[model samples]
Every structure is written in C-alpha cells, then in structure tokens.
Target chain A: MSTIVVFVEHAAGAPRRGSQEALGAASALGATVVAVLCGNGADAAAAQCGKFGAARAVVLDATAWSPDSAAIGVAALVRAEKASAFLASATSSGRDVAPRVAALLDCTLFSDCTALRKDGEKLVVTRPWLAGKLDATLRSSAPVLCATLRRNMFAVKETGGTAAVSKGPALGPGKAVLEKIEARAGGKLDVAEAPVVVSGGRGLKEAPNFALLEDLASAFGNAAVGASRAVVDAGWRPHSEQVGQTGKTVSPQLYIAVGISGAIQHLAGMKTSKVIVAINKDPEAPIFKLADYGIVGDAFEIVPALAQAVRKIKAQG
Target chain B: MKIIACIKRVPTTDLQPRVAADGKSLDAAGVQYMTSFYDEIAVEEAIKQKEKHGGEVTVLTIGSAEASKEVREALAKGADKGVILVDNAWGGRDPLATAKTLAGKITELGADLVLLGRVGTDRDNASVGPMLAALLGWACVTDVVGLELGDGKGTARREADAGTETYAFALPAVITCQKDLNEPRYAGLKGIMAAKKKPLEESPCPPATSQVEIEKLALPPARKAGRIVGEGAAAVPALIDALRNEAKIL
Candidate 1:
C-alpha cells in the first residue's frame, strides 16, 4: 500500500496554514496521510497535523533540522519512509526544500500544485503554468512523487480523529547551522500573509503622496501595503513590495487597488484574491472589470474618506 | 573566471493571452516575446561580475529559432558570445526536462559558475535553478540579492520571508539572481552593432524525458460587481456602517 507523507512546516511552535492545506489535500489523495515534524519540540506541529486529518504523525527529533538543515532532514525522512507521495507548501522554505528532496530521491516534483487526483494508477497533479495563464496536468513516472501546494488554494478542515504518533531516529549531524534572522523595516504584515492588501500605483503621483495608501491600509488595520511594477521600477517603493507576474503572487481575502489601471501582468498576481476593489478615475480601466467593487473617481479624494470611515467604525467597536 | 548565464524567452506577460482549442497551450497569435525580466538581471549581473573579476560571459538559452534574437540581445548588452541549445522536439517540455537539457549543455561547456534568474516571468515555478544544482551535485544559493566572489569561493545574501540569509559556497556553484541583485543595462547602438560580430554557437541536443504533463487550460472565473457606499470623507460614515454590518470586516 502507498503512503502519503506531509512535511510539517512551523515557526517557533505555531503551524503554518499552508501546511494544514497540504494535509487536507493529502487526505483527499486516498493514501494513509503521515505527518513528519523534523525540528525539536515538534509536539505542537504533530498535534496540529492530527487535528487536520493526518492518520499518523511522526516526529523526528533532530536539532540539525532546525531552520538550517531542514531540507536535508526532510530528504532523509522521505527516503527512510519509502513514501509514495511527499507533500509540501509552496512557501519559501518549501520551494527551497522540495526540489532538493526530489533530487535526493531521484524522482520528479511539481511545484505550486492547485489540485490533485488519481488517474488510474498514476497521480495526476494540476498546476498553473505561465503565470497562472495555463493549467497543466502532470503525471510522474518515478515511484516517489512530490508536490508543493499553493497557499490558500485548498481549505483546511479538522477531521476530529485521533492520530497515531510515532518517533523516529535522527539522521546525523547536519552540515548547516541556524544563524540570526534580521527583519525588514516594515512593521506592516507581509503581503503573502495579509488577508487584506491595499496597493498603490504610479497614479498616486509622487512618493510622499503614498500617504493616502498608508492611511487607507492603517484604517483597515489588518491590511498590508503593496505597489505595482511601474511604481517599484520608478523607485517609489522597494522591489520587495512589488506585486506582479515577475514579483510575488498573492491571493489575499480582499485586495484594494488604488489609482491603478490594471495591466495584464499586474492582474495575474492578485486576480485570485477573494474580493477585489478598484479605485480609479478611469471608468474603463481594466481593473474595473475584475473588481468586485469599483469606484470611478479621483483616488486622492476617495482614499482619505475611506480611511476616516474605517477608523470611525473601528473606534465604535 | 568564466561565467555561464542561462536565460529564457517568455511571452511579455503584459498582454492578455488566449488558450488554444486543445485547452492545454497558449494561442500565441499576437503576443510579443522578450527575455524574462529576471533573466535580464542575470545577464546584467554576469556582465558586472565579469567586469569586476576579468572573466568572459557567455549567454546560453534553450528555445526555438526565434529565441536566438534574445541571445543576440544579450550579446548586444555586453556578453562575449552566445550559445543556443536548439531542440525542436523539446519545445513543450516541462521545467525538469528544461533543466536537464540545460545542465547537460552547461556540463559540456565546462562552466565554472552558473547564473540563472530566480524564476521565469511566465511559469514562476522557481524550480529549475535548484534542480540543475542538484543534478550537477553543485552548491546553490537562490534568490540572491547580494554577492561577492573571490579566490574560487563566494558568499551570497539571499532574501527569505523573515529576513536575509547569508551563505558561503565553493566554486562551480549555481546562483539564481533576484530583482534587487543589480540594475540591468540597456544595449547602446555601438553594443548592438558589435553584437553582430560576437561568436554565436548553435548546438542541438536530444530531447529530455518529462515526467509531468499538462491536462488543460482555462481562464479564472470573474468576480461579481460591488456597490459603492457614497463619496469623500463624508461618505466614510456609511462605508463604515456597511463594513461593520454588511461586510463584517471591522
């Protein structure tokens, strides 16, 4: 019988949402889902994985697996278990680790898979190619198949079933060590993790004028700040903050684009957001067609008002 | 020092794309193509590194005949030469196949250092670089924003979700350039003319075996229309009420 191995990703002790999504997908894939936690004190991750429907949770106690050699340890676990399928989240860590694990197993992997199914005896994986412009179905010939699920693509569910927990022996001494981590300047939430994102474009006119976007985002409280390719190319904001086909692909619950005419490349990244709001003076802007809510007016006047209104509501609460 | 930079010619994602009737490929009727934005940065970084370390830069690409134009563009920008890995049979292969083909060519060329874009503009998979490194059994540093190379060793600063991570690796390593790594340069008229004379080599390789295949392609569903509350700061009151009572976000 083939078994499914879901690699658990966590920070400190809290589990990442993408990891839960991977477990959910694994459960649907018809294999006995096994969760593998590689770092020290992984009981929390194991429990969370069980709550999310893993049939069994395996904790591999290895300090070397702590941020630095996590990939090597994951490769080792995948090899030792002889897992037929290995699942990961498509975050930075997953992206870095999945390919290496696949290489170690001498197998092929599909990244950013949105869905999966069994086609006869082979597993057919569905993934967005060409910046989400094309959906491709992939089948692997190797005995071990690997995939990284996109964030928020699958819903997380709790099966309320008890999971069998097991402990595994450590691999060996790791080659890399965890050094210090330095944070970025922005205290705002990351664009990828934010439920709501308010982004600005060149239409905001100048750098300081971005205050309108800041005010609006602050009003939302849970929102993050983002920018278009043009604004970032013009050096109005850092490249890290850019969102487009070339930059970060985000699918926040709500995305508000300000003073922006949606270009195809720009739309590709955020079109998947649950609710879209476009604020632009041009009624015919491409953004209007995609927005769930659109206001055809000057952003300078609309944004400030929106901010104040949001503030008032929050204060009332 | 010798550097090999791998590039791809992708459709300029700025335009809307149409799916063919087969529902598995792009129509490609009027869409324009260009060197991927990240690959441009890779080429520029290679040129800058060559300028600093006194080495030769060779730009390599795997694509159809039209992709040679992108190689010429790289040569025009300052590369010493250009090489095209032409495989008509491998045009529609997956990322792993593409990486294997490129790795074979890179090995044949005897590259000391390999540079690639963090990810291509079209696919956004971010897999080929690491896969190539694994195939070659070479050290790799990905999403690099800063780099320093000397004495057959290198150090790189890579961007992560939490922060920057620094890594040190020996020579014959693979480094994927990110957007913040360097500013790409434009090809001047002189460089464009000089590019015509640069050595352009064409090599054909056998098609790589692919384990993944595409099933279908379709457009994303459209969002429903949303109602506007009012106008200006005065309208803010009603908007707040809507968000609280209607949307429940607040």
Candidate 2:
C-alpha cells in the first residue's frame, strides 16, 4: 500500500476536527496512514491519532509557532516514511506551512482540495478554481502529492485502533518567528467554520443595524455572522467576515443572505452551502434565484421575528 | 531597501465562466482581465515601503506579454520599474514551478523584501509566496493583514481561525498580503504619463514541466430553483418549520 502522511493539528491535547477529517480521508483511500504532530502537547495528541484512522504517529518536538520550522519537520517525516502523499487541513496555518513543505520536497502544493481519490496508481484531487466558479480535477506527477483538505468536506471516522507512536524529528530554527497571538473574542464562531452563517449586506442600512443579524446568529446558537463585499468594503464589517470571490468562500449547512442582491461574486462564495435562505425587500433580488427558501420583505422586521422564533424553538428543546 | 511586488493578471469577478471546448481550461471568450485583487495591496505596500525607507520598488509577474498592462499599472502607482518573466503557458504551470521561476528572478534582483497577494485569483493556489521564500532560503509570512517595519526587520499580523497572529521577521523575507492591509491608490494622469517613461523589462521564463495535470474542468453544479416561503415577517414561522422538518438543519 502507498504510504500517506497527514499533518495533524491539535488544541490542548486533542486532535482538531479538521485534522481528524484529513486523517479519515487519507485512510479511506486504503493507504498506510501515518500522522505527524508538533508543538505543545503534540506527544499526547499523537497517541490519539490512531482512533482517527492513522496507523502510526510521529511526534515532533517543537513548541514554537513557526510555519517554516514546522515545514522542515513535516518534510523530514515524509522522507523518513517514504510517503507517496502528504495532507493537511486547509486552515490558515496549514496553508502557510504546506507550501513550504512541498517546496522542500520539490513538489507542487494543492490548496483547499474538496475531494480526493485514488485512480489506479494516481492520486487525483478536486479543487475549486477562480474562487469556486470552476471545479477542476487534477493529478500530480511529483514525487509526493501534497494537498490541503478543505474543512467539513470529509468524514471523521473512529476505528478503535491504536497507532504505534514514536518520536520523529525536531524543528529547525525559523527566520520568521511568531512573537504573539491576539485571540479573537472568546466563544465567537468564525464564519468559515460555523455550521450556520447569517450574512448581511447594504440593506442593513448602517453598521449598528448589524445587531439584528447578531441577534439572529445568537438565536441559532451555532451560527456566525458574515458580510457581503459591499458591507465589508464600506467598513460596516471586517474583511474577515466578507463572503465573496475576493473574500472567503464559505460552505455552511445553512447560509442566510439578508439584504444582499446576490452579486455573482457573493453567490459564488455561498452557493455551495447545503441550505440557502434569502431575506430581502426587493422581490426581484438575484439572491432569491439561488436561495432554497426566500422571504421577500424588509429585513428590519423579518430578522427580529426570525430571531424570536429561533429562540422559541431552542427553548422548547 | 529594495522591494519587489509580485502580481498576476486574472479575470474580473463579474464574469460568468463557461467551460472551453477543451473541457480543461477557461474559455477565454469575453473575459475581462485585471490585476488580481490583493496584488494591488501588494504594490501599494511596496511603494509605501520604498517611500519610507528610500528604495526602488520593482513590480514582477510571470505571464504572457499581455501582463505588461498590469505591470505598467503598478508602475503608475509609484513603483520604480517592472519585470515580466514572459511565459505563454503561465496559467498551466504548477505552483511550485511558478515559485521556482519567481525565486530565480528575485535572487537576481537582490531584493530586501518581497510581497505578493495571498493567492492568485486564477488558480487560487495561495502557495507561490511561501514556496518562493523556501526556494530562496528566506523567511515567509502568509496572508498578512497588518505590518510595521524598522531596523531591517518587520512585524506582521495575520488573521487565523482562532485569532490574529503576530509574526516578527528580519529583512530579505517574503510577505503575502491580504485585503485591508492598505487601500491601494489610483494612478493619476501625470503618474500614468510618468509610468510610460519607467523601465519595464521582459524576459523569457525558463521552460518548466508542470507536475500537476488537469483532468477536467467544469462549472459547479447549480442549486435547484427554490420557492418563496412567504412575504415579510409573517414568513418566519414557515421558514423555521422548513428548516426543522425538511432540511433538518435547525
């Protein structure tokens, strides 16, 4: 079997959901899966990788947050294991490190791949091009197929297996070092990872009006507030919340677009969402064309009412 | 300080793409082209650094001669010069190959700092900047939103899933720009005329064999047409009912 090395990220002492999903994806292809972990608490995290489908785990002794340094460790692990493929979650840090690892191995790196499969002797990946407008299936001819897997796209399975854990390599010093981290306000969900996204546009009128969207998101309990490019460009919301071609592409279980006219750019970001709901005053809004369910009315009145209903539903539970 | 900003020419976001006859590439019909969105920020940052540190800003790209339009646009925005590593098959080159070519040019230029958009709008690989840095044996920070430089070193902040991460790196490093880093300035008529007088050099990129092969390219599946739940606030109950019962997403 071909050996597949997966770079697993962890929080505290447990593996992150996205990293487990990446491990699940690698094992599903019938490859010999090896998991690699680094940084603080990585030793404990390595022992847990087997439950997520990794057959073996290597713990790298590195405590600092330096992508280049981490890349050096991952590249060394790949060569040590003679892996045919390397995979990581397509998170901010994953994207930062995987490219350097690929470069070290003299291979091309594929970012944010949504699908992976083994075709005979080839490993094929499916990824979005041009900001989700085009889906391209690709095959690699490099020594190792390096890719970052998109979150929530793959399954996380538990096999009740135990991995043979061992110490691997130590990270080299990085020229660029992480000095500090300023965490976003605690308990707030990121739009990209949240299951539900409540996005607003110019129809909100002003910045303060976003409180209505926030209340709705709060009612959902698991939802994150997002923004259209119009609002983000106008400084009504941070660029981090913008959902469009030029912004982040979000694929949520439920995506609600309020006051958005559904520009091609905005639609491309959320159209892949499982369920789309649009609330707009304009009856002819383009967003309605893509919404699985749409409410044609003033968002000012409908959003508050929706929030109340959601709260009631949660209360009943 | 010597600064270089790398950019790519891509189709505007307004385009509704159609699959070409080859079924593996853009149709290239009526597609309008512009500098990739975040690259304007890269150019702006480069010029700002040049102004603050007294250096020459060089805009670089690897594409067909047509990419000169974007290079000249950067020059008009205060870059001292431009270089285009002419590659007719630029769009088809894999990310590592593209980074290798750019790394060669950056080394030859002996730049102190290099900036690039987090990802090219075309393939959206988001790999070239860090890959280039690795190939050149330099430090790299990706998706940078804020930055400050002094004493031959820089501090940058990037937005991550959990929070904002601050990184400190020395000179001769690579930084990939994100939006909100700065508002890119528009070129005035005088600036445009001056840009015509600026140097724009073009050279043939070394032929590189791509490691990744596109098997197929197609538009994403369209969402099924949907129904209007109801009008106004009265629609809330029905929407909730559908979410709970039909979609089971509540």
Candidate 3:
C-alpha cells in the first residue's frame, strides 16, 4: 500500500478536530498512514492517532511555532517514509506550512479540498474554485499528492488500533521566528468551526446593534457571530467574521442571515450550509430565494423573539 | 529597500460563474476581470513600503497581455514599474509551478521584501507566496494583518482561527497581506496619466510542468427552494418546530 503522511496539530494533549479528520481521511484511503506532529503535547496527541487509523506516528522535536522549520521537518519525514501523499487541515497554520513542504518536496498542493478519493493508483481531490461557485475535481501528477482538507467534511474513524510511536528529526532555527500570540477574547467560537452561525449585515444599522446577533448566538450556545462584506468594510465587524467570497466560506449546520440581502458574493460563502434561515425586511430579497426558511419583518422585532424562542427550546431540552 | 508585489487577475466577485463546454474549465466568455481583492492590498502595501524606505516598487503578475491594465493600475498607485510573465493558462497551473515561475522572476528582479495577498481570490490556493519563499530559501509569513519594517528585519502580526500570532523575521522575506492591513488608496487623474508612460514589461513565463490537472468542473447543485414559514415575530414558533422536529439540529 502507498504511504500517506498526515500533519497533526493539537491542543490540551489531544488532536484538534480538523487533524483527527485529516487522519481519518488518510486512513479511509486504504493506505498505510503515518502521522507527524510538533509542538508541546505532541507526544500525547501522537499516542491517540491510532484510533483515527494512523499506523505509526513521528513526533518532531520542535517546540517553537515556526512555519519554515515545520515544513523542513515534514519534508524530511515524507522523504524518510517515501510517502506518496501528505495531508493537513486547512487551518491558518496548516495553510501557511503545507505549501512550503510541497515546495521542498517539489510538488503541488491542493488547498481546502472538500473531498478525496483513490482512482486506480491516482489520488483525486474535489475543491472549490471561484470561491465555491465552481467545484473542480483534480488529480495531481506530482510524486506526492499534497492537500489540505476542509474541516467538518470528513469523518473521524475509531479503529481501536495502536500506532507505533517514535521520534523524528530535530528542528533548526528558521529565518522567521514566532514571537508571541494573543488569544481571541472570551474564547469565542470561530465562525468557520461553529455548528451554527448568526450573521448580520447593514440591517443591524450600527455596530452596537449587533447585540441582537450576540444574544441569538448566545442562545445557541455554540453559535458564532458572522458579518457581511459591507459590515466588515464599514468597520462594524472584524474581517474574520465576514462571510462572503473575499471572506470565509462556512458550511455550518445552521446559518442565519439577518438583514443581509444575499449578494452573490455573500451567497457563495454560506450557500453550502445544511439549513439556512434568512430574516430581512425586504420581502423580495435575493437571500430568501436560497433560504430553507425565511422570516420577513423588522429584524429589530424578529431577532429578540427568535432568541427567546431558542432559549425556551434549549431550556426544555 | 527594493519591493515587489505579486498579483493575479481574476473574475470579479459579483459574477455568477458558469462552466465551460469542455466541462473542465470556466466559461471565460463575457466574464468581467479585475485584480484580485487582496492583491490590491498587496500593491498598496508595496507602494507604502517604497515611500517609507525609499526604493522602487515593481508590480509582477502572471497572466495575458490584457493584464497590463492591472499592472498600469498599480503603477498609477505609485508602483515604479510592472512586469507581466504572460501566460493565458496561468489558472490551470498548480501552485508549485506558479511559484517556480515567480521565483525565477523574483530572483532576477532582486528585492528586499515581497508582498502578496493572503489568498488569491480566484483559486483561493493561498500557497504561491510561501512556496515561492521556499524556492528562494527566504522567510515567509501569511495572512499578515499588521507589519512594521526595520533595517533588514521586520515584525508581522497574522490573523488565525485561534488568535493573532506575532512573528519576527529578517529582510528578503515574503509577507502575504490580509484585509485591514491598510486601506488601499485610489489613483488620481494625474497619476493615471503618469502611469500610461511608466515602464511596463511583458515576457513569456519560463515553462514549468504543472503537477495538478482538472478532471472536471461544474457548479454545485442548486439548493431546494424553500418557503416563508411565517411572517414577523409570530413566525418564530414554526421556525423552532421545523428545526427541532424536521431538521433535528436544534
């Protein structure tokens, strides 16, 4: 079987959900899976990779978060194992380093792929082009197929197996060095990873009016607040929360667009959501055309009522 | 300081892209084209760096001769010159090949710093910048929202899903710009006239073998049409019922 190497990132001694999903994807390909990890708690995380179908795990002794250095270690591991494929999640750091690793290996990278499959001896991936407006299925002719899988798209398998764990190469000091990091306040959920997203647009009227969105998001408990390009450009919301072609493409289980008229750009971002709900004053808004359910009226009156209803349901359950 | 800004011409954001007859490419006919959104930021940042550090800013791109429009626009915004590595099939080439092509040009141009958008709005690969840095053996930081350049060194802050990460890197580095880094300035009429006379060079890109090929291209399936469950605040109950009982996702 061909060997596939997966780069795993972790938190609190466990693999991040996206990393687990990457391992799961590699294992599902019916290949020999080797996982490579770095940073503190990598050993603990490496030990748990077997459940996700990794046959072996290599922990690189890199404590610092340096993208170039990480790529070096991953490239070395790929060479050592003669891996035919490499996989990582499409997180910020993953996107940062995977391309460098591919360059080191003299290969091309497929970013934020939504699907992967084996075709005879070739690996094929499905990814969004034109900001999710077009889905392109691709095959890599490079020696190793390098790809970053989109989060929440693949399943995490439990094989009840154990991976043989070992140490890999030590990292060298890279030219770019990580200094310090400031975590987002309140440990707020990221819109891309949230189960439910409550997004607002100009209909909110002002920055402070987003309190209604926050209240609704709080009611959901796991929901994140998102914004349209207009709001983000107007400085009413952070760019991170913008959901559109130039922003994040989110596929949460539930997506709620309030006061958004559903520009084509905004629709491209959240159109893949499992269930969409749009609330706007304009009855003829384009967003309602794609929404699974819609409420027409003043967002000021509708949002508070929806929040109360959501809280009531949560309380009963 | 010598600065270079790499850009890509892409379909405008408002476009509803359609698949071509080949079933593996976009229907380019009648599609409006413009500089990728973040690339505008890249061009702006390059001019700013030149103003602060006193150097020439070269705007580089890989596209058809028609891309001169984008290059001239950058020049109008204070870029010193423009270079187009003319390639009609740039969209078909994978990130590595694109990086190698750029590395060849950047090596020839010689720069202290390079800027690119965090992600190309077209393919959304977000790879060429770091890949080019690796090919050139230089440091790279992606999704940079804030930056401060010093003599032969710099500090950058990048946005991440987890938090904001700060990095210290030396000169001769690649920094991929994120939105909010700066508000890109518009070119005035005088600058536009001046841009018409600025040096804009065009050459064929050195051929590199692409490792990826598109097997198929198609639009995602249309969402099933939905209904207005109810109207106003009174609709909340029915919406809740649908979510709890039907979607089972509440």
Candidate 4:
C-alpha cells in the first residue's frame, strides 16, 4: 500500500483540530496514513494520531514555529517511507512549510484544497481560485504530491486505527531566527483562523461603540473581533484587528459585519467566509449584497438585542 | 546593493473570474490586470529600502508581454528598471517551477536582496518567495508587515495565529510582503510619464514542465439567496432562530 503522511499542526501543548482533520481526509482515501509530529514533546501528540486511522505516528525533534525545520523533518520522513502523498492544514504556518516540502521532493504543492481523492497512482485536488470565484481540479503525477488542506472542508472521525508511535530524525538549524513574539492587539483568537469573527467599522461612530461588536463576538464565545480599515486608521482599533485588502485575509466559518460599509477592499478579506452577516442602516450599503443575512437598522438598538438573542440561544443548550 | 522585486500581474478579484472555453484555465478575454496587491507593496518597500541604503531596485516578473504594464507601474513606484520573462513555458507552471525561473534570474543579477508578494490573488500560492530563497540557499521571511534593512542585515515582523512574530536575517534574503506592510504610493502623472521612458526588458520563455497539472475548472456552488429575518430588535429572535435551526452554526 502507498503510504500517505499528514503533518501535525500544533498549538498550545497540542495539535489543533485541523491536524486531525488532515489525517481524516488522508485516511478516507483507504491508504495507509502516517502522521508526522515535530517539535518538543510531540510524542504526546502522536498518541491521538492513531485514533484518526494513522498506520503509525512519528515524532521528529524539530524546533517549534520554524517551517524550514519542519519541512526538513518531513523531507526525511518522505525519504524513509518513499511516501506518495503528504498533507497539512493550509494555515499561515502551513502555507510557509508545505511549499518547501514540495520543493525538497521535486513535487508540486497545491493549496486551499477543498476536495482530495486518490485515483490508482494519482491524486486529484479541488481548490477555489480567485477568492472562490472559480474552482479548479488539479492532478499531480510527480510520484509524490504535497498539498495544504483548507479547514472545515473535511470531517474528523475516530477510525481507531491503533498506530505504533516512534521517534524520527531531526533537521539542522533553520535559516531564519524567530527573535520574539508579542501580542499587538485583540486577544488569543486571530481573525484569520477563528471559526467566528465579528467586525465593526466607521458606522460605530466612536471607539467605545466597538464594544457592541465585542458583545456579539463574546456571545459566540469562540469568535474574534475584527475592524474595518477606516476604523483602524481612525485609531478606533488597532491594525491587528483590521480586515481588508491591505489587512488580514480571513475565511472563518461565520463572519458578522456590523455598522460597516462593504468596501471591496474589506470584502476581499472576508468574502470567502462560509457564512456572512451584515448589519447597516444604509439600505443600499454594498455589504448587504454579499451578506448571507442582512439587516438594515441602527446597530445600537439591533446589536444589543442580537447579542441578547444569541446569548439566550446559547444558554438554552 | 542590488534588489530584485519579483512580481505578478493578477486579475482584479472583485469580479467573477470566468473559465476559458477549454474549461481548465482562466478566461483571458477582456480580463483586466494589475500588479498583484502584495507585490505592489513589495515594490514600494523595495524603493523605500533603496532610499534608506544606496542600492538599485530591479523589478522582475514571469509573465506575458502585457505584464510590462505591471513593470511600468513598479517603475513608476521608483524601481530602477524592469524585466518580464515572456514565454509560453511559464503558463501553468507550479510555484516550484516559477521559483526555478525566478532563482535563475535573481542569481544572474547577483542579487543582494529579493522581495515579492506573499501570495498572488490568482494562484493564491504564497510559496514562490520562500521557495526562491531555499533554491538560492538564502534566508527568507513571508507575510511581513514590518521591516527595516541596512548594512548587511534586516529585521521584520508579521502577525501569527497567536500573536505577532519578529525575525532577523542577513543580506541576500528573500522577504515576502504582506498586505498593510506599507501603503503603496500612487503614480502621479510625472511618475507615469517618466515610466514611459524607463527601460523595460523582455526575455523569451520556453515551454516548461511540472509535476502538477490542471484537469478542469468550474464555478463554485453559488451561495443561497438570503432573506431579511426581520427589522431591528424585534427581528433578533428570528435571526437567532435561523442561525440555530437553519444554519446550525451557533
């Protein structure tokens, strides 16, 4: 059987949910899947890989947060297994790592895959291009293929494969040195990867008015707060909270825009979101044209009531 | 110092992209193009670095003859010169292949610095800059929102999932500009007319080979038409109900 490998994307002390999802997608191909986890104490992460149907889970002693180090480790794994396929979540970090892995193998790396399937000796990947405006089906025939999978596109399930775990080889120091990491704004949840995002804009009128969007995001519990470029430029919010062409690109599961005009720049950042909700008093606001749900009303009255309704619904459970 | 700003001419994304008659590539008829947003930022940043340190900025792109417009835009932004690798070989080339051509050009230029957009809107592959760096055996940083370069070293910052991260690298590094890294200045009439006379070089492109190929292209499933749940605070309960029962995301 051809061996397929999945890279483990880690967070605070553990692999993130997307890591399991990658493994699950690979397993659905009916091939023997090996999950590779690199970094300190990554062995613990391997323990759960078996539950997702991995044939084996291997740990490599690579430095954390270094794509180059992880790619080198994966290169080793590929050589050992002569792996036919590799997969990782298409997160910001994954985007940094997967290409180098492909380059190392002389294979082509495909990104933002919504569907992947194996056909005999080849694999096909479906991806959205130009902001989901179109879909392209890509085929790889390099004997080895590398791809980054989009989040929420696959389901994670327990196959109870019961894989054997072991330690693998590590790579040398990476070229770039990570000097520091600091929180610039918002909180732990980044708008780019958050499952839910609630954003505010100039319509809020003042910095304190942003608290309304915060309340709505708080109601989601897991959502992050975002800001329009106008608000960020006006000093109503930090640049880290800004979402637009010149800001962060996010494709969260749900995105709510409040008191914001939908400039194409801002829409470009979040238009790929699975669900979009827009609230603005201007009936002709361009945001409403793209919103999955829209309400034309003053945010002051509707946001508080919306927050209350969301809280009530969550409390019911 | 010599700086190479690798660039791409991507289609404006606000409108829908149509598949060609072959159903495997983008339709080119009447398609409008501009310098990819991030690459524009890279160009502006490269010019800024040149202003700070004595160096020349050379804008390079692997594209058709039409992409010279993108180069001219970079020239208007203050690049010293421009080169567009024009060849059918570049068509359908994967990120790795694109890196190969770029690395060749950068190497030929005896580069001391390289810059590019983190990702092109068309391919959305934020891979070329780092791939080029790896091929050249140089350090690299991607999605950079902040940067400072001088002497023989550079420092940069970017946002991460948890927070912001800072990195330091030496000269001959490849740095990919993220959006908001710097606001690209507009090309005024004088700058635009000056770009008309700036040297723009074109290189022949040969057929290329890659491990990846596109099989088909199709439109994504259209979003369902939305409905107004209600009006004002009175509609909040209905919206909540729709989210819980219909969308089931909450």
Off by over 4 Å in 1: A39-44, A58-69, A117-122, A137-142, A160-179, A312-317, B225-230, B234-250
Q: What's the lDDT for all of these models?
A: 0.79, 0.91, 0.92, 0.81
lDDT of 3 by residue, A167-197 (tens): 9877888889899988887889888878899
Lowest-sum lDDT 10-residue window in model 2 chain A: A181-190
Give the alpha carbon lDDT tens digit for every residue of B1-250 in model 4.
Answer: 7988989988885655678899888887888888887898899988988888878999999988988888998898788899988965565888888998888888887888898998887777778887887778788888888988877888889766667789877887899987668888998888888998988989886556777778999876656777676677777777777777788888
Per-residue lDDT of candidate 1, residues B125-234 (tens digit): 78788778877867777788988899988877777766677776778878889999999999999999999999989888677777666666677655566665554445
Candidate 4 docks with a DockQ of: 0.62
Q: Report the TM-score for the A-chain of model 1.
A: 0.89
Q: Score chain B of candidate 1 by TM-score.
A: 0.95
lDDT of 4 at B102: 88
Rate residue A260 of model 1 by lDDT: 82
Could you give the CAPRI-style class of model 2? high
Minimal lDDT window, size 10, model 3 chain A: A37-46
User: Clash pairs of candidate 2?
Assistant: none
Q: Which residue pairs come into collision in candidate 1?
A: A137-B213, A137-B214, A137-B215, A138-B213, A292-B226
RMSD of 4: 2.5
